[model samples]
Target: MPQIQSELSFNGLSVLYQIAHLLASGKDLELIMSNILEILETSAGMKRGMITILSPNNEELAVDVARGISETDKRKGKYRPGEGITGKVVATGRPVAIPILDAEPTFLDRTGARKGLKHSDLAFLCVPIKSGNVVIGALSTDRVAVQDAVTLEGELRFLEAVSDLIAQVVQTRRRDYDRIHALEKENLELRRSLENKGKPDLMIGNSSSMREVYRQIGQVAPSITTVTIRGETGTGKELVARAIHQKSPCASGPFIAVNCAALPESLLESELFGHEKGSFTGATAKRIGRFEAADNGTLFLDEIGEMSLSAQSRLLRAIQEKEFQRVGGSDSIHVNVRLICATNRDLETDVREGRFREDLYYRINVFTIALPPLRERGADVMLLADYFVKKYSRLHDKNIERISTPAIDMLSAYHWPGNVRELENVIERAVIVSTGNVIEGHDLPPTLQMKDASEQGERNDSFENLVAAYERELIVDALKDTQGNQTEAAKILGTTKRIIQYKITKYNIDFLRFRRGDSTGDDE
Candidate 1:
């Protein structure tokens, strides 16, 4: 309610700074307007301040926020076009300045906002917040001394500058709606591509852990060093490699990707190093390898940990010397290509265990980035879940507007062993099956329902009941792992089949109960 003095408040540059500071807080728009009024009152030396927003119909204006309007009178009073001086100011689409409140014949006093204040002693200044070339809303202030109206010079000019800024805010927010809609559309197209024998390379997460990923990318992208990305399978290691390629110096060039694990040793050797005609039985013609194809660009080697030992030796030579001969030819085909390798396996551990070559590991590990599994990103799970739902809904031509809050809670609680890749698949599946505007917890995959019962926050439960529920789930899970092949299950579980059978029967271990893919286990 504190107002600023006029001479010090309504100046050029200072107002813009204040407006930016106000917007940065991200408060409610109404609260923002109230603060604006209070600042005008204190700094502009106004007795009272009010701001009216134009309704969509444009026939009436709503008193969105005010500094001087009492709660009781505010509920009883409202503003309409051509009713009072404020309305006339809006209707004329120009600022109004009444020197003497009582001398103005057209003035109508309906604001019973203040009790003891003489109506005639008040002077009014009102200007509209414009829409396009026309006025959409009005900003009006009350001054006690009529003579001070002229002294409060340049107030209208200051307000008009702010009006322009508010217009920009509205325009920018309208663009956000369009952007959000467009993002949904792109997501839909990507989902369709994914459903029809295609892959979308989804990256999901906004946690601090994910921030580390972005940071590492920024750090290494400017350099020309070989990078090795490590994480569990389905954790988006390839996506990380792609991000590195995108942010790197060779971004404009080709980004050739090769899966080291998917190809056979012979085929992989030919793939990495170009082959001549008749290099092998299938080599009917010459072929360019990934290295030559990615010349002056970047080559992304996926599942690098699975590369054959012989291929590893050849790869090390090519990486270290930047030269390699074709599979059947002796000519040294030199190419300048940045190397980026991704794998779910721990290359350091593999090297120590003698499964991976230490020299190759060191060469590729010039820079390393490790991505965390999805469950570790906290609220980022919900962020990504909503993104996917909106995306797939549009792609599949569905109408899922949102995911319910409970569904978000379920997402946060569940452990995504397959990481981001698995979470995205689950969301796509739910979007395909969901039948409402919002996705609910029941719509989620069965693995999410395997509640950590020992946690006190299973909706509600005493500590003792929580523990009991946990024990119940564990016993049921152990039986499920056996898959009703009880004798073998029992031996693997280190218990007699009879005792396992007793627990199974006690916990209702019928495979039919777990029939909807109900078994919840972590693969990573």
Candidate 2:
């Protein structure tokens, strides 16, 4: 008897050491738990081992991992709190040891794993897995009945230790899952907000003029009609063309863009139509052209009014005949393509001056969508500014919270001659150079401050007031950056802490508002 007891003690210790190693393996939680149960069955004489975890809502327990049970049986093994042996253990936060499974009326073999076995010859044991004072789940197993009470108690105690290890892993995994879910939710919300602000297409504006542009895009996108986008430079003419192409039936095909003004007249023809090898001095290999590349798709010709009259003749033939010969290649390489053209110059004036083909202009002018300049979109300036601020803040790794009121006035008052593209560049530069959380008026370019005489007369502010306002804005921004720490603010401003205090008093600034949580500060 002494020899047998010594072997069991040594085996129990070995089993516990293996369980500890398995818990620290950093593997998938289900796979690790399954491996742990397999070890218990083979080494510790346990059988039909299973682990059950509480659901997220904590209303029911379901089998999460099991050994010696079919997957179907494992899935069927579920219980409410206090419903069965497993449920009772988790509900009461205690261990249960049934000496004979047949004698326990509460023993419900939910999995039916022991169906063929004589119930009188089986023993069942279960222990609660707890995280702090809350029971999160239960671990259970059964074995051939043990006659000695001490041996049954020993088996139950070993299972309890294994459950404790599982509790730690479960808690850690749940925390990681929760964090990932929260991040996914936050991302979904941001995408929805962007979509709402730019409804018909992702162009970003809610003004009446932008809404009209969106309506025109929607009206003409489903058809095969040629589209001409008319707008000033930097007014998002290419963006409008793209929106039409994306909504068109040819969205799945390639979208090729070319700038007629950027290419010389000598190369413009060869660019639109493929060049045969050995056709020209530097035409080394057979090169595919933009029209062929955009087969079954959209070809965006920007600044189309700049194309030479010779190139315009070939383009008009292609539009009329739906086919054209490559430069220096007589083979009429036919292609099916949708054409979208953009131009800032008036084609009517060019036609009269013989700079543009009247026939080609009429063909591309089947559908026209005019983009609104940024200066004309009343409230859209602020919307676009905020959008650019958020975009550049993330790109440059800045924490810019908001634009200051004075900066807003400056942005609203300035005429955006360069349009939306210029505004985007301005915001990106401001984000890169800002030293605090707020974008102040001084952070903007000097051009915005240079107002015309008529504009200056309307405001009629003195130079002294302007200087004071600028100074107050700088001091407030510094305080916000330092979290109301006047010493840090003063150091950032290249002044003494006492000067910062005096300035704060002079400006009637609530420095405490910048501090998070506790609204108190001390400067050393």
Candidate 3:
């Protein structure tokens, strides 16, 4: 068959290729959109352009991108859906091309597509980027013409192709978003399943202090002793509570925890004992209390020292009698929950200060566990650091293989005023931010280091700059040897065109200098 007359203009093909390459290159979306408009105009010879899409709420179609249009003109017709040509295509789910404007119909150009007002002798073409029979968005481009039918037909074809490309892009984006949302929801459920006593991986330490804690947990976790853990914040007190329950025969039961300091007294009480329907304003339904939720399991009260004295008194009675009434309910309910309390404050001192209950302290102090903070854990920091680095790197999908030697030294030397919990948080942050395969000193937070963060940032910047400069020099030397021809240079360096281009951009290598075109701005 003989070749047919081509409608795909050379300029339009170039623009399409550019857009496709940009989408393929995986560049950030904002940059891709910024240049897309100019490229489109160069190809299809459009005077104005607008890209509109259905919002996430699906309540309205809003303009996400527009070019050749002004803000004032947009106000007149810029922010509505199915308004003019753009809206017609979206609503009808079909392309609309205005060849001669019919009888010069009034253009309610809500898009202000090009400039701020309606154009003279304006011709328009709009196409819907439909996905799965539903129009996700519309692409409209206008031109200055006197309603020439043949010219409009060719332009419409150009836009139809653009619309097809756009539809694929939109469908692909929606799929990626749906997949990500599903993964996030799944991870949230998994996190809820894995978490216990507010401590992740709640394992008991083998140290002497923790051994005693374990012994107490073994003794009281099975039996119903209102076990209260005493230690500073971030000391693995909650972990000890979890350990007791795991070791106890009630290992099959739920392990529920509530931070007393985090919630208000009313909410905390309701959380613990639950509330009857109509208990208070916004109590739409009867809610199960934590004790009822953790029935036959262990109930952990973290920051118990901060709980209200009245709450503590009620809590003490529940501990002694193994029963309690819900808030605003007259009926008393019996529960078989084992109580485990943790506190960073001294309850006895609180008792003396007349803030905490003496009776409640005595009841919960039946089994006491005090966790030594991380600074006193001997080589445990190194042990936990290694364990956490590996665990969290996999969790965050990071490339970190291990902590560097200097990082280890810093970890070990740090006083850890906040204890094991703080160490975990710092390591997690480093794992998130660090780009290298290993955790370096600069990766750690400035508060964790001897040097200020700004100083550390500057030092890292300087070092990176030095390295980049050295690499640029190496590339330039290779190119000179190859007589400024990239293919030969790449062969000489045993690389590819892509790699050379990357280095050239990274080092800002000047080919013109090597080409003998000019020595101007050689320093840059």
Q: Which candidate leads in TM-score?
A: 2
Q: For residues 391-475, what per-residue lDDT tens digits would candidate 2 score against the true structure? A: 8898899999999999999898788889999998888888888999999998898888679665566565656666775788678
lDDT of 3 at 426: 93
The lDDT of each candidate is 0.72, 0.83, 0.71
Residue 465, candidate 1: C-alpha displacement in angstroms: 16
lDDT of 1 by residue, 165-252 (tens): 6655544444554667656754663454346423323455666567667777889988998998878887777667666776788866
Estimated TM-score for each candidate: 0.49, 0.50, 0.48
Give, for candidate 2, the lowest lDDT window spanning 10 residues: 1-10
Cα-based lDDT at residue 138, candidate 3: 78
Model 2's C-alpha root-mean-square deviation from the true structure amounts to 26.2
Clashes of 3: 4
Candidate 2's C-alpha runs over 4 A off are: 1-200, 452-524
TM-score attained by model 1: 0.49
| Candidate 1: segments with Cα more than 4 A from true spot | 1-204, 452-524
